[model samples]
Target: MTNRALVIQDNHHQTFDNDAFMQARNLKAEYCNSGTDALHAIKSHRYRCILVSMDMQKENPVEIIGALRHAENTSGLSPTPIIVAGKDFKLTQSDIGRLNISAQIRSHHLK
Candidate 1:
């Protein structure tokens, strides 16, 4: 298995320094600046984990998780762990259960 991760973040609101995180973890990372690109990357590659920025402007992080989950289901792939990263977004327990999110990482924790 590849020690790789997919990072989905909007270009404009890049608050988290994903490179530093990846470097610290000793993992290779593929960055997707949009949901469309992220979807395409998810289809083509398998990641150890996916880190999605919650501060996206064009796409809702929940929506992205839903789509990725659906794709994994239809493709008969194991669910990849997803970690939501952001500064001020709150994910309700209901949303977390529904989305099957693996974990969440606040920006402060990353630093």
Candidate 2:
């Protein structure tokens, strides 16, 4: 595994933090509040994997995924891979056929 991961999570979970995950996994992790913030982070650094909250910014993490996959200047990250996380089960089947999302993680059993 690479030593870096970027995490985008909603503000709803007051205690939701990627620090612990980063420390435990020995990764260089960065956190962002919204899809926009995440996009900025992506442009600044290259990550092996990106973990994003599913319902962030109104169940629209797909847009962020799209933006990354379609970045004009950074076109090769199209296959970088992303993991979507959320508290709801509905996101598992989210119609993200247009986005290049890699996986979905349910918050109840989030690792």
Q: Give the candidate number with the greatest TM-score.
A: 1
lDDT (10s digit) by residue, model 1, range 28-109: 9898988788889989999999999998987898898889889889999899989998888999999888888998888888
Q: What is the TM-score of each candidate against the true structure?
A: 0.93, 0.71
**Which run of 10 residues does model 1 get worst, by summed lDDT?**
10-19
**In candidate 1, which residue pairs clash?**
none
What candidate 2 gets wrong by more than 4 Å, as runs, is: 12-24, 57-59, 72-74, 89-97
lDDT, candidate 2, 1-111, per-residue tens: 567898877664633345555677677877777777777877777787888776675547666777777773365653666877666635434455556567766665444
Q: What is the lDDT of residue 68 in candidate 2?
A: 70
Task: Give each prediction's root-mean-square deviation over alpha carbons.
Answer: 1.2, 3.2
Best model number under lDDT = 1
- How far does residue 83 in candidate 1 sit from its true spot (Å)? 0.3
